[model samples]
Target: MKASHFLFFILLLCICIPASAQEAKMKKIFNGKNLKGWVEPANKACWTVSDGVLLVKNEPAKKGAILWTEKSYQNFIFQADFMMGDGTVDSGIFLRSENDQIQIGISGSLKRDLTGSPYIPKLRYPVEATGVKDLLKPKDWNTLKIKVIGNTYTAYLNGQEVMTYSSADMPPSGPLGIQLHPGNEMSISYRKIMAVAL
Candidate 1:
């Protein structure tokens, strides 16, 4: 083979190798068929899967539900598509268990749309995300991506960087969870859930 062709081949190989490896590192935590790798802290009836979407519905008869991952992660990137059914739906994506969470919908009483905000429940207040109000789709699906590295947390909404925060009290490792706030009658759906551990 020609020297120029050989050099070009080597360059392509180098670029493709890492991209392939990075893709391989990602693991799909949710299977569309069932709740195989998740735990419902409250009850099974609160959570359900249908037609490739994971639905968390508020149950008036039961307490608030949190669906947690079976496996824990230290540093990882989470990707998912979420949408609210209707009205004011309160929900969030819990990081490293229930201590830390990223707000996905509105909060009750406060009536604030804090999507993309990184907050510590029952502890510190939420750090509001910028450019989130314009990006959020109330009646449509929105893409969310979160990257947690050590104490740093970064969030992206609809392919745009929404916010980044650092916390000293962040846990070293834990499972991720999706919350279904009780009391109010609301429903939230999630699909294409995946994670890549770093």
Candidate 2:
């Protein structure tokens, strides 16, 4: 082959290699067909997949059940689309087990909407998000992005930066969970759950 052609080939390979590696690094936690990678909770009837979306009917008897990821992660980016129906929808995305969770819908008390809020479940204190009221769509799908690096977490709602906070109490690694907070009969759905480790 010509020297110029060989040099161009090398340059092309340099650009293609990183792109392929980056694509391989990202993993889809949800299959959209079934809960294959999720550890099904005791109240299995509450969770189901329909038309490639995970939904919780929120039965009163089966509240507060979390659909947990079988695998755990640390220092990663998680992206998903979620929607909640009318009435009080109290749901959250649990990071690092049951402690650190990004609140998605409303709290039962009706005091805090908590969309895009970074909170510690045990502490009951949330690093509240700003400019989120107008961003969140009621009874409609909203995109949520969360990046956790070490003890620091940054979250966004519908492509808008919401909040960033650091916590020393969170574990280095733990399973990600979707919570159906107890005592509410509100429907919630999640889809396109994708994650990439940093």
Best by TM-score: 1
Q: Candidate 2 on 11-85: residue-level lDDT in tens?
A: 999999975775567778998999999999988888999888998767767456899988888888888999987
Query: Ten-residue segment with the worst summed lDDT in candidate 1?
Result: 118-127
User: Each candidate: RMSD to true structure?
Assistant: 3.4, 4.7
lDDT of 1 at 144: 94
Model 1 lDDT per residue over 1-198, tens place = 999999999999999998578657878899888999886564788788999999888776736788889999998899899988854688888988777888888866467888898778565455788999889998899999998999899999998999998877778999999988777688889999999888
Compared with the true structure, all predictions reach lDDT values of: 0.85, 0.84
Give Cα distance to truth, residue 2, candidate 2, Å.
29
Report the number of backbone clashes for model 2.
0
TM-score of each: 0.86, 0.85
